[model samples]
Target: MTPVTYATALYRNLLRLNGLGYLFRNVSIGMTDHGDVRNRGFLLKIKCDSVTVLRNVRQKFKTLNLKDKSVARIFCRTLHGSTQNEHNNNIHDIDYITFTNCDNDTCKILRNELLLLPNFVSEEEEKQVVLEVEPYLKRLRYESSHWDDAIHQYRETEKLKWSEKNAIIIQRIRDVAFPQGVKQISFVHVLDLKKEGFIKPHVDAVKFCGNTVAGLSLLSSSVMRFVNTDNKAQFFDVLLERRSLYIMKDTARYKYTHEILKDEESVFKGKHIPRDRRIAVICRNEP
Candidate 1:
C-alpha cells in the first residue's frame, strides 16, 4: 500500500487518454495539509473496498464513445501504414496501439497515471542482469529450438517472487494492477515465437486498467509486427532491441493485431539471416 500524502477538493475533472481511467480527486488546488495526503484518503473512500467504482467508470467510458474498439480504429490509421526499419517480408503485431508517431496536427493527450512506476530495475540486480543475462539469453536460443508455436510465462500472483530485481519490477507492476482493492493477480514471463521463426498476423489479449499488461523487458534481438485486423493485415515491424522497455496499453493491447514473423528461409532483398531466440518477461495482473 502507498502512503498517500494527497488531499481531496483539488480535482478539476476526469479524462481518458488511452482507454484507462483515473480517479483525479483534488490535490493541488491550494488545499491544506490535512495532516496527510487528502487525495489518497479520498481515493481510499471513492475506490472503496470493492471494485464498484471501477466498473461504473468503465460503463460511463463506453457511453462517451471512448471504448477500446473506437480507439483501436484510430490507432490503425495513425500509423499511415508501417514504420521505419521495418522489413517488407517480416510479419508483425502489437498488443497496445499508441499515437506516438502521429502527425503534428493531431491531438496529444499523454495520460499521466498518477501512479507512475518510476523504477524498472533495482540497482544491484540491474548490475547483475547486465552482467549475466546475456549469457542466459545465448543459452535460451538453442533451447527455444525445441519449443514451437507457444507462449512461455511465469507468475506474479500471490504465490511467489522472481529474482530480487524481478521482484522489484513485479511489485511496481502490481501497484498498477491492484490500484484498487483487487482480488487476484497473475504474472508471467512470456515469449511468442515465429513457428518457422517468424509470426503470422495476430492480435494480443493483454489489458491495462482491466486485466494484464505485457511489461516487456527485451533480452534479445527481435521485431514485433503490427497490422490492422479489419484490413488486409498489411503490416510493419517494431524492433525489440536489447534492453528496451515497452508498455502496450488499451486498444493497442487487444486491437490492431500483431505477430512476430517466423520466416527462416525467404527472400529479404535476396539475403538470409538466421533467426535467434527471443526472450521477454511477461508479467500479468488478474483480479
Candidate 2:
C-alpha cells in the first residue's frame, strides 16, 4: 500500500478506535439522541477492500437485563477476494461471512453474513422456501408495501416466520438488520438475475431519521459497478468478495448507481472475477 492509502486506513481505524472507549458527552436531543450514528453529507469515502475475516467479539451482556427490550450492533468484516467454483451447488459456497451471537458460549449459533440460523430450520428447508417464494417475486413492485400478497405483508415477522422457510431466512436477516423492532429498514434482495447477469442504475429513496448505511452481503464474487452519473466513463468497480460485507452510504448512495455486470467475468483490483448464481443480503436497520 502507498503512503496515501496507509494514511486513509489510519484515519478510518482511528474513527473506529475512538468509538471504542469514547462516550457521548453532549446531551443532544434530535434524531440520534446519543449521537451514535452520525449523518454526514455525500462524497464520503471508506477504504476497506475485498477480503476480511473477523470473530464475533464475545460480549457478556449484564445478566440478560430482562428489563432491556433489545440491543443491536453491526460489525463490518471480511472483504477479501477468494475463488469460487461457478458449478458448486452448495449455496453456502457463494457467501463467506458470519454474525456474532450478541452473547456467546451457550449453544452453538452458526454465524453468517446473511442467514445466521438461530434455532431455526435447516438450510435445505430455506432453499425450498426460496424456490417457492421466488415465483412471487415477479409480483414484487414499487407500489406494494412489501413482497407478499394482498392478504399478508412481507414485513410481518411473527406470522411469516412460523411457516415459510424463506421467512425464517428473512427473519434472521431482519434480526441483524432491524433488530430495533419498529419501523422497517426498507431493503431489497435480488437473487434471480437475467440469463446474462443483473443490476440497475438506481438510487433508493431513503427516509431514515438516522445515518442510514447499506450493507451488501455478497454470497459470490460479483462486480458492483459504481459510476459518476455526471461522467459516464469515469467509473469504479468493486469486487464484492464472497462472505464479506460491502457498505454504501452518504454521498456514495446518492451520487453513484451500483450496477451488477451481466457478463460472466468482470475485472477488479487488476484481477478478473467470474460470476455465479449469486445471492446478496441487503441489510439495514432503524427505530
Candidate 3:
C-alpha cells in the first residue's frame, strides 16, 4: 500500500483503540460502513459520557501515524441493536415495515387481508384466470418502453372488472388495510419486469390516490429502494420476496420515492438471490 493509504488505515485503527478504552472516559465505539467521510472506509462513532473526551479524541486522531507497521489489518464487527436497529427505525418513520416471511400460514392470512391476493391458485387455475382477464389486460396502457429498453412490460387499469380475480383481491386488501377504509379502489397496476428491467426513483402522485398503497410480489424476488425526498442522501433498501406483501403509508407513501433497481440480483441477510421475470400488483387507495 501507498504511504498515504497506510497512514489513513493506521489512523482509523488508533481511533478504534481509543474507543476500546484509552481516550473516552465512558463510551462505546460503534463502527459503520455508512460513513459520509472517506466514501468507502468504515466510520468510527464514539458515544461517550462527556463532550470534552469526544473532542479530545478527534484532536488526537489528527496527528497520529503508524510508527511500527509494515502492513495493516482492520477487524470489524457490528454491535447488536446498535447500528442496524437505528437504520431500521430511521426508514420506518411511516407505518411502513417489511414482512419478509410471507409464506407462513399466519402471514398468508394477513397477506390476504392486507396486501396480496388470498388463496394461492394452482398452475391450471392461473392459466384459466389469465385467459378470462386477457381482454382488460390488453386494454390497459403500456408503460414507457424506453424506460427498460423494451425488456420489461407493464399494463394497468383504474377500472375494475368483476370477472377478474385480482379485482376482488384488491377490494379485500383495501378493506382490511385501511383504517377509515377505502371508499373505492382508486387504481391498480400490474408490472411485468424482465431480469434487466427496473424502475427509477419517483414518489407516487398524491392527486391520483390516498396515503396508503399496497403491493404484491409475484414470479420473482427483487430489491426495492426507498429514498427520502426531502433528504436525498437518506435512503433504505427492502427485499421484496416472492409472494410477499408490502405496504407504504404516512411518510413512506407521501415523503419518499420508491424504485426497483437495475441489478440482476441482490444479496439480502447474507444470501444471494437472483431476479427473474417479476409481476407486481400495485393497489392505491381512493383519493
User: Estimated TM-score per prediction?
Assistant: 0.43, 0.41, 0.50
lDDT of each: 0.35, 0.35, 0.48
Ranking by TM-score, best first?
A: 3, 1, 2
List the candidate 3 regions with Cα displacement exceeding 4 Å: 1-153, 164-167
Lowest lDDT 10-mer window, candidate 3?
A: 73-82
- Give lDDT tens digits, candidate 3, residues 1-287: 43334333333333332333233234455544443332223344556566754565544432221112221221111121112332343322212223332223322222122222222223443354445545766666556564434223455444445455544445534533354323646656656665667777777777877777777666777777666676666665666766555666655666667788665446555566688767666667677
lDDT of 1 by residue, 166-280 (tens): 5554454444333234444463544434334555455543343344354544434444555545554343335443433444444444554555544453223234333454445
Candidate 1 C-alpha error for residue 147, in Å: 9.3
Candidate 2: Cα lDDT at 229: 56
Name the candidate that leads on TM-score. 3
User: For every model in order, what is the number of clashing pairs?
Assistant: 38, 12, 0
Whole-model alpha-carbon lDDT for candidate 2: 0.35
Scored by Cα lDDT, where does model 3 land? 0.48
